[model samples]
Target: MSVSTPSSRPSASSSASPSVADLVAATPADRNRVVDLLRGAAILVVCLGHWLMAGVHVDGAGELRRTGLLGIATWTHPLTWVLQVMPVFFLVGGYANAISWRGARARGTTYGGWLRARLRRLTIPLLPLMLFWAAVAPLASALGVDGGTLRIASMASLVPTWFLAVYLLVVALTPLTLALWERCGWWSVLGGAAVAGLVDLVSVGGDLLAVGFCNYLFVWGTVHQLGYAWRDGALPGAAHRLGLAAVGLVGLLLLVGVGPYGVSMVGVGGHGVDNSYPARVTLLFLGLLQAGVVTALEPALARFAARPRVWAATVLVNARIMTVYLWHLTALGIVVGLSLALGGVGLHLQPGTGTWWATRPLWFAVLAATTALLVTLLGRLEQPAPDPRPAPPAVLPVAALLATCAGLAVMADLGIADADGTVNAWLPWVPLVAAVALGTVRLPAVRRRGDRSAPGGYLAP
Candidate 1:
C-alpha cells in the first residue's frame, strides 16, 4: 500500500556476500523481538478465528440456535483472510530456521545434528500433550459422548498437527536450500517458483500431490530467505520492503481474482480444498504478502520491542506459543463440551438471518473467558527447556516407550490388527509423530565432542 522507497539501503546479496554465520550472529535482539511479535500475532489471529467461529449460546429458554453464520462458517469455511496468519507463522519460521542453522554452522555443528536439535526443541514437549489426548480419546468416545463432536475435535487437531511435520521437513532441508540461495540468490527462489507454477498447471489436469510439496520448500523457503535479507540489511530501505508488499498484494489479487483459489485463506470444508494444501499457489502469494508486511513494519516493530516490558511480555508469549498452539482446539473443545454437558446450550447457536453474526460479540466473550482458563491451566507444557547435560543412553527405553504409546493410540483408533495381519484403517499418527519428532529434538546436547557450545544454542547475536 505504501509505495515510496526510502534511501540508504544496504547491498543486495548479489552485490555482496556474507558468511551465513555472520548473518546469523548479526541478527539483533530487536530483530528477534519483531519476529516474536509477529509470532505472537499469528497465534492471536488463529485464536480469534477460532473464537469467532466457536460458541455456546443459549436462548431465553436455553436452546441451540440451529442456523447461524457461526455454524455455517465453522463447519464449512473459516475466517480465511484473517485466519491466514498461518503463512506468517511459517514465513517467520523460515527466518528462525535460517538464523538457527547459520548459528549452528558457525558453532561447527553438523547439519544433521543441528537440524535434529532444532526438531527436538520444536517438538519434545508435545509428547505429554499427545499422550494425554490419546489416553482421553477412547474415554470420551466410550462415554457415549457425541461421536460427531469427537470427530470434529479430532479433525481440528489435525490441521495444526500437519504443520509440525511439514515444518520439520522444511527445517531439515534448509541447509541445502539456503546454500542455493547463497549461490544463485534470487534466481534460486525464482527457480522454485517456476517449479511450483508448473506443477500447479499440471494439477489442473492430473493429481498434483508430489508437485505440490515443491511449495512447502519453495514458497516457505523464499520467505525464510527474507530473514537473511533482513539480517544483511538488504531490505534496509522502506521502499524495498514496501515493494515486497506491493508484489504480495498483486499476487493475492491475481490468485483470488483469476485463479481457482478461494478468498478465504484458511481451508473451507464443504466447499472443498484443504486450502492449506500446497497445490494452491494462492498460499505462496499470501506468504509473499505476509513477508512483505513483516519486513516493512520491522523498524516500527523494533522500536516497539525496545521497551523492556514489551519484550518481556513477548518473551512470555513466545514461551507459551507451542503450548497455546497445540492446546487451542482443546480449549475450544472444552468450552463446547462443558457448555453442552451443562445443558445450557445445544452445540449450535440460534441461526437466524445472519443472526449469529450479531451474536458474535457474545460468542467472543465466552471464547476469551474459556481460552484464558485453558491457557492458565495447560500452557505449562510449552515452557520446557532442553536439558543442558548429556543424558544417559536411553535409546532402547525411549524407543520402547514411544512404540508402546504409538501402538496403543493407533490400535485404539483402529481395532487390533486383522486376522490377515492387516491394519484396516489408517490411524492418525500426528500425536505420536508430534511426540517422537519433538522428543528427538529435545535430546541432551551431544556436542560433536570436538566443539562446545551452549545447550539449545543458536548463533551468537
Candidate 2:
C-alpha cells in the first residue's frame, strides 16, 4: 500500500547511508508527503493492533493456547472502528497509481514494461519468506511441537500474504481501472459501491458465502476509485469532505445498528458475521468516512509533514514499509515461541487484566526489538539489483502475475503447514517458481549488426 516514489530506493552503499537532512533536501518539490505519512502510519497501526489483540497463555495441561482479545472482551468491538485502517492504505494506493500510471504513459512506457517494473518490486521480497517457512515447518514438526500450536503460529506469521495477494491484483488492473476513471469519473465509484451492496445483500439473504468474495474488488476498488477522485480534485472543499463523512456515518449506523452486520470491523473467529474476510458494504462506508475525515485534515497534515525532521522519518519508514509489514507478525511468533519455551514466564498473566495491561510496555519492547532485528537482516532483499534482462512477450508477465497471486492465495488459506505440522507440498515451490518466472522472463535474442547475438532488447519503452 505504500506507493513510494522512485527515490525511495535505499542508498547504493550501506556504509555511506544518507543522513536525514540529506534525504529531506533531495525530496522533489512536488512530492506529496501526506500520502507517504498516511501509508507509514497505517502499516504501523496494523502491526501494533495485531500485537495488542493477540492473546496467548499456557493451558492447564501446560500447552500453549492462542486466542484473540476481541473475541474474549466484547466491549472492545467498537475500537476496530479506529484500528481498521486498511481503507486508508487502499485509498493511498489509488492516488499513487493514478500518478504513477499517468507519468509512465507520458514517458511512452508500454503496459508490459510498466507492469514488470512494479511486479519485480512487489514479488521479489517474497521468495526469502517462503523459503524461511518451508524450513521452519519441518524442523518444528521434528522437534515435537504439537499440530495445533504449529498451525496457529504458521498462519499468524503468514497472514500478511493475504493482503499482498489482493493488492497485487488491484495493482495489475490499474491501467484498465484508471482508463475507466478517466471516462466514467464519479459514476465509476458509485457503480462499484452499488455492486458491492448487491453482493452483500445476496450473500446475506441467500446464505451464499462464496458470492461475498466479489466485494474484494467492488469495495476496495471503489475506494481506490475514490482515490482517483482525490487526485483529480473532485472532492475539493471542506463541505464536500464533511458531507462524505456524514453519509458514511449514517450508512454505518444503519448497517450495524438497524441491519445484520456485526459492529466489529475486523474479522474475529466465531463471531458469526464478519465485516471483513470477503469484505462487506460496511467497510466501504468506513472507508468513505475515513477518506472524508483524512482529506478534510490534509491541509494541516501536509503542513506538519513539511517539517524536515518529520518528512525524513516518514521517507525512511516508507522505504522499508513492505518489509516491516511482512515480518512484524513473524517477530510476534518468535517471541511467543520463546515464551512457551521458558514455560510461559512472562505470558502467564490473564489477558484484559490489570497485571497484563501493566506489562504491555515490556511486551511491545521485546516484540519491536525482535522485529527490528529481522528487518535488519532481510530488508536488503526489498531492493534487488536492476533486472538487466529484456522484457519478455506480453503474455509472460500476465501469466507470471496470475501464478504469483494463485500461490499467495493458497498460502493464505492453508498456511505453510497443516495442524499436524506437515508442510504443504506447495509451500516454497509455487511462489518460488512464480518469482523466478516474473524476474527472469526475457525477449528472444536478436542478431546485432556485427552478426553477434544481442542479449538485451526491451519489449517496449
Candidate 3:
C-alpha cells in the first residue's frame, strides 16, 4: 500500500463522493479532519458499549439492581478485549493535543489560553447535568431512598468522569510533554512505558498495589506520547500502521497467554486487572493496535466520513458526546427504577436463563430511548457555539482544570453524592461545573484572523 501522507491542502478532485481531501479543504487550515473523525467514532463506540454492557434487573423485593454485563457472563470476557476502546480514545487525544499544542505555540497562544479553550468545550454543557443531579440528589433523599442506593445512583451517573479527569491532566501536561519529547525524543515514551511495566509487575506481584495507580499518568502518558509520534510524522505510511497493528496483536497474545493478565481487556468479575481501569502493560499494546487500525483505515474512512450525510451524523453524535456519556447510566437507572416500580418485569428472569438472553435487545432499546430523551433535553449546552468568547485569567483556567481533576478523583473514590445528599459528602461535585464557568468567562474576547470557534478543532476533543 502507498504511504498515507495527510495532505495539508485539500484535494482538487471533483469526484462524486467528497474525498478526505475535500473535507480538509472545507475545514479551517489547522484542523485535521481525520482526527475529528476518529474522535467522533470513538465517542459513538464508547456510548454504545456502555449501553450494551449495562446489566439491570429487578429483584424479588422489587428493587432495582445493577451489575456489569461482563460479570454476568464471565465466559464472555474475551469480548471485552474487542470492545475496549479507551486505548483508542487516549491515542486520538494525544495526537490531537500534540497538533493543537504545536499550532497554539506557533500562533503564540499561552498554556492558559489553549487549556481554557479546550476545557470550556468539555465542561460548558456539563453545568445543567451537574445542577440537575445536585438538586435531585437532595430531593431523592427526602423521598426516603436508602443511603447506599442513593450513593450508587449518584456515582452511576458520573462514572464516565474519571476518564475526563485523567484526560484533563493529559491536556494540562501537553505543553511540558511535547517539550520533553523534543529533547529526550522517544526516550520520553520509553521512560513512561518502563514505569507502567514496573507498576503492572509490582501490582501482580501481590505488593505495592497502591503504586500501580501511577499508570494513570505513565501508561496513558506513554499512549499520549504515541500520539505525539503520529502528529510529528514519525509514524506515517501504511507500512507503519500495519506493522504496529501486527506487533500489537502478537504482543497481546503473548501477554494474555504467557503473562498474568486476563483475556478480557476490561478484566472480569472481582478483578479489574486488564487493559481497562488502572490500565496495565497490555494497554500500551492495545493502543498500538487501535491506533494502527485507525491510521491504516484513515484513507478509506476519511472518504466515507467526507460524504455529507456521514459527516452530519458524525457531527451530531460529537455535539452531544459529553451529555450522552454522562447521562447514559442515569437513563438506565431510570428504566430499572421504573421497571421495579411496575413489577411486571421484576424477578421475571434469572441471569444465565434462556429468557434473560432474549431480553437483552429490549433492555438496550429502552436505554437508547431514555438516553435520547435526556440528550434532547440537555444536548444544546454541548453544542459548539459559533462565536468565540472571551476567556478569564490564566490562573482561573489552570484552577478550573486542576479543580475538576480533584472533583473527578474524589468521585472515583466516592460517589458524586451520598445518601441524604449531604453537602460535604458531595463537595467534590462543585468543581465539575465551577471549572467550566471560570474557563467560559467572557473576559475581553480576543482572536486572530481566519478564526474558527470549533472546540476540539482548536485543542483536540
Candidate 4:
C-alpha cells in the first residue's frame, strides 16, 4: 500500500536521470533492501498468479467466456497458499507507514499534512484508471458487448481498485493503530486478531452475513500491525519467527481442516465460504504464516537484495509498483480481448489441456509485453507532483478521505458498468470524489513575474 520512490544520485548534468548503478549506490545504508525486494516480488507474484488462474476461451458459440482455473481444478485450491500474497503486501505497508509516520512527526508535519500526503500518493494514481473505465464501459456496451462479457472485463480490470479501497481504509486509520501499537506493543496485534475471530464467529455462527465485512479491517489491520513489530525489531531471532509460523499453521489447519472455512485463500466460484471475499480468520492465519516464513528468510533475502544488479532491479520495480499493479490485469484483459477478436487463436485450447499448459510461456510473454507498454505510458501518473502549499484545514482531508474510500468501495463492488454494460449509477461520482481528494490540499497556482504562461493551474497533490 506504500508507494516508494528510489533515491537517485545527482547526475553531472541535472537534466539526465540517474543510471541504475547510481540508484544502487545512492541507497541509504539503513534502508532495508529486503523489504523493497519482497514488495516487488509480491506484486509480481500477484500478477502472475492472476494471469495463470484466468481461464479464457472463445466458446463453441463464438462468444468469449472466462472462468477461474481454481474453480475448474479444485486441486489448485492449496496452491493459493503460496499465491495469495496480500499478507506480505499489508505487512510491508505497515512497516513503511510506521517509518513514514514517525519521520513526518519528527519533521513537524501535522497529522493533516501527513494524512494529505499519504492520501494523495494513494489516490492520484487511481484517476486515470477510473477515467479509462468510465469512458469504456458505455461505449463497449453500445458496440454489442454482452453484459456477461463486460462484467467479466470490468471485474478483472478493477481488481486492484478493490484492494485499494481496503488498503486506503487501513492507511487512513494508521495514526490510531500505530498509536495503539506504541502503547500496547504485541497486544495491539492480538486484539485485532481476536476481533477478527469474533467477527468470523458472529457472522458464520449467527449467520449474519453483513457483519462479516468488519473483518476487512480487523484481519488486514492485524497483519499490518505485524509490520510495525517487524519495523521495531520486536520479532527477532529464529525462535520468534518459527513460533509464529507454527501457530499460524496450526490455526489455518484448525480453521480450514476442522472448521467450516474453505481451503482456498483466493475466491473460487462455487466453492463454499470463500476465505478471501470477506477475508475470514483463515486469511489472518495465512498472513501470520507467510510473514513468519518470509521474515525468517530475511537474512538470506537481504544478502540477495544487496547485490548491485538485484537491488537496482528492485528499485526500478518499486518505483512504479502502483502503476504496475493497477494496470497488469487490464493488460491481461486486453490480451484476452485480442485473442477473442482473432478467432480465439491461442485461447481456443481448453483449460487444463496439454496444449493449454504448453502455451503458458507464449501467453505469459504476451502479457508481460502488454503490461510493460501500459506501464511506460501511464506510470508517470503515479508519481506525486511537487506541492509546496500548506496543508488545508484538517476537515478537508478528513472529508476527502471518507469520500474517496466510499467511492472506491462502491466501484469495487458494483464496478463502473452494470450487467448490461451501461455505466453504473455510481460511476459519475467516482471522478468527482477523486477530484475532491486530489484537490483537498492543493493550492491555486501562482505565476512568477514576467511569466507569460497561464496564471493558474491545477496539480495533483
TM-score winner: 4
Identify the superior model by lDDT, candidate 1 or candidate 4.
4
Across 1-461, the per-residue lDDT of candidate 2 in tens digits comes to 22334464334453233433445555667777788889988998999888888887776788777768898888889899889998998998898888878878887877777788777677767777888887887788788878788888888888888888888888878999999999999889888889999999999889999999888888988888878888888899989988898888899999999898889999886664789977999999999999999999989999999987788788667656777888899899999889888887887777888888899889889988998888788765554445555656657677778887887777777777776567674665777787665553222243223211111111001
Candidate 2, poorest ten consecutive residues by summed lDDT: 452-461
lDDT of 1 by residue, 239-316 (tens): 887887788789877766777666666654444334455536667766667777778887799789768667666655
* Alpha-carbon deviation at 14 in model 4, angstroms: 2.1
Which window of ten consecutive residues has the lowest lDDT sum in model 3?
Answer: 1-10
Model 3, range 231-253, lDDT digits (tens) per residue? 77777799988888897889888
TM-score of 3: 0.83
Error of model 3, residue 259, in angstroms: 2.2
At residue 140, give the lDDT of candidate 1. 72
Poorly placed runs, candidate 4 (over 4 Å): 1-13, 16-22, 425-432, 436-461
TM-score of each: 0.74, 0.90, 0.83, 0.91
Give the TM-score (vs. native) of candidate 2.
0.90
What local lDDT score does residue 376 receive in model 1, on the 0 to 100 scale? 70
Error of 2 at 114 (Å): 1.1
Error of 2 at 222 (Å): 1.0
Instruction: Order the candidate numbers by lDDT, best to worst.
Output: 4, 2, 3, 1
The number of clashing residue pairs in each candidate reads 11, 0, 0, 0
